[model samples]
Target: MDSWVDGQPADSLSLKDRGLAYGDGLFETIAVHDGQPVLLDRHLVRLADGCLRLAIAADIQLVRQELLSYAAAMGEGVLKLILTRGDGLRGYAPDPTAPGRRILQGNPAAAYPAVNAEQGIRLFPCSTRLSHQPLLAGLKHLNRLEQVLARAEWQDSEHAEGLMLDQAGRVIEGVFSNLFLLRDGVLLTPDLKRCGVAGVMRAEILFQAESLAIPTQIADISLEQLQWADEVFVCNSVYGVWPVRAYAALSWPVGPLTRKLQTIARALLDA
Candidate 1:
């Protein structure tokens, strides 16, 4: 097992840590291939942003170096890095002088069905609606009870992922991935300014789409809008990309745009 606590060899942490007490932390799930962490810069960028947003003091460059070393040791797997506002006394207030802690864990990458990318996967519309929290929106914070509750709605593997919506009935994202769709030749992804995680792969897709000259937009898509789309897909750093063939009663055929993004996604993930 590859694990580290605060750049040391320990595998355990203090019980009073803020991360454990109040979920005051952020994490990054990175895909490793051939001794490399994919999109490392992007991941670090998001991490740094989260740290700043939460007022968590950190040395991001040092953390990046540690991540690379830890990732290479894994050879091929998933690298999970957690940063928490070090342990503090019992209270809601944080101690500004407390240095943050970094916890790293490595595990074998999951082997998803090849057909998931080849043919496609189905979606389940989760009843758990995300609350409007602009302060925490787009940040991969430790608070993930909403996603946990939504994922608990289904037990079978019939649906590879569940789609979540905001309180306003606007489609937000998949349980663990960002959502996107192709409608009338335009690529549409849900706006995460109000909720949902702004994933690294999702950012790369937007950049790649611009270079590919594929029209793209970030909008509040309703369930009806998603149903009327020509094609649908979901993405995360680890999974790269997954085409959605069906969601509830609506079905879609994998279109040309999805295929193009899939190629780019795989390349980036394997890079």
Candidate 2:
């Protein structure tokens, strides 16, 4: 499928686009199933919040319409929506009146071994650490050099995902997913107030847990805390959830809470 730029099919972006020049933008990678974007409202909410925080003058209603149209045409696969600050002048200052640039690219559904979800996966201890940026934290922004470097730390299939930490040695998330752990029947995830992308799936799981009367917490996680967790899992909007069996010297079993949430997540992505 061809990429769409501002509701029109285009193959190239302007050279002066702020997203290209200074990574001044936000993005959302959505999952399309049966011609509809899964978790569409949540994605939109996050995108809108990002635009508001970044002070980007984006017509979110127009972006929503474009996403629906694009997903309908795509039918199935992943849709990556890139919202740039439009073409800009030769410096860091952005034009206050410039409209946001919307780009939609479609790709085939992700293919991971079934064993990853069924049996469980190992976590590669990534040496690359996330930087602290409260203003930009939790927004799926265009700047992803930290994740790029973290992902590059491993190249083998032995580890299905890599665990990332902040410079302060606080466990944050995965290279492309959110991290969660179950301990004493309570679900706990890292607090993204300081860093990390607050993933759509992570938010959904938290909400689902709350509705089901399961205890959930968002707190600063340390390596010591993760070691004692009864169960560990990683998740994203596209891949749903995968139980984590091992990380470094620590290991955990697939607990009941993890499976319960996994079933909910699976239903959401497969629905």
Candidate 3:
């Protein structure tokens, strides 16, 4: 019930798969509710971009149909879609004949305590700074050792998430989510031109903000700027949005901006 590989029921992938051997693949973590995959078109758009960048042949129609089918079967949950360069001959060279593989898996929808959404969650300032790679920026590729290391920085229940900074000490994003800082009635997220995943929920919020006339910008944001922010929220497609109540020595009361966006985000998820 948890997995399907290449449209067939299977748990194990080939050992020679490029995704495992070289992290040569892209992925999307989507939220499914009542048989609908939220922001599906947006997810597919991103997946296509990744495929183009990696020069991987993408069967978009097949991938989209399969995701919908998988999500419907699961009813409501989280869906992890992985598309790899398929099996390859032993070496660093990519196999020219490889026809990509699709691996879909599911998890029960996570239940965030009401307080975290109603109030906010604490954040740990991770010591692991993300490396800069402009060419690879914003793609949800399989190379996640950086995030894995950052998440390992803490083991405390008090911190619900870890805030990661880039090499320049600019706040890039949360370990597993995107971050937005509301400052002086403006919405701002760290620009992913240099690094960080351009999350699907982040895209939705940006579009909604534009329609609502809520000023939004994307640029390099420093820790001091976030410390002085009126509100800060972290988001991902699976979790929607979570306000940041406390990070390091700073504390913020859940503000109007985060609430306003959450309303739209929830509606978009159900739409």
User: TM-score for all predictions?
Assistant: 0.97, 0.99, 0.97
Model 1 bad stretches (over 4 Å): none
In order, what is each prediction's RMSD in angstroms?
Answer: 1.0, 0.7, 1.2
Write candidate 1's Cα lDDT for 49-115 as tens digits: 9988899988898899898888878899999999999888989898766558999999999788888
Query: Which is the leading candidate under lDDT?
Result: 2
Tens-digit lDDT track of model 2 for 52-116? 89999899899999999999999999999999999998889877677799999999999999999
Kindly give the number of clashing pairs for every candidate: 0, 0, 0
Give lDDT per model, in order: 0.91, 0.94, 0.91
Candidate 3's C-alpha runs over 4 A off are none
lDDT: worst 10-residue window of model 1: 90-99
Model 2, residue pairs in steric clash = none
Candidate 3 residue-wise lDDT, 98-164, digit = tens: 5589999999988778777777899998999999998899999999999999999999778889999
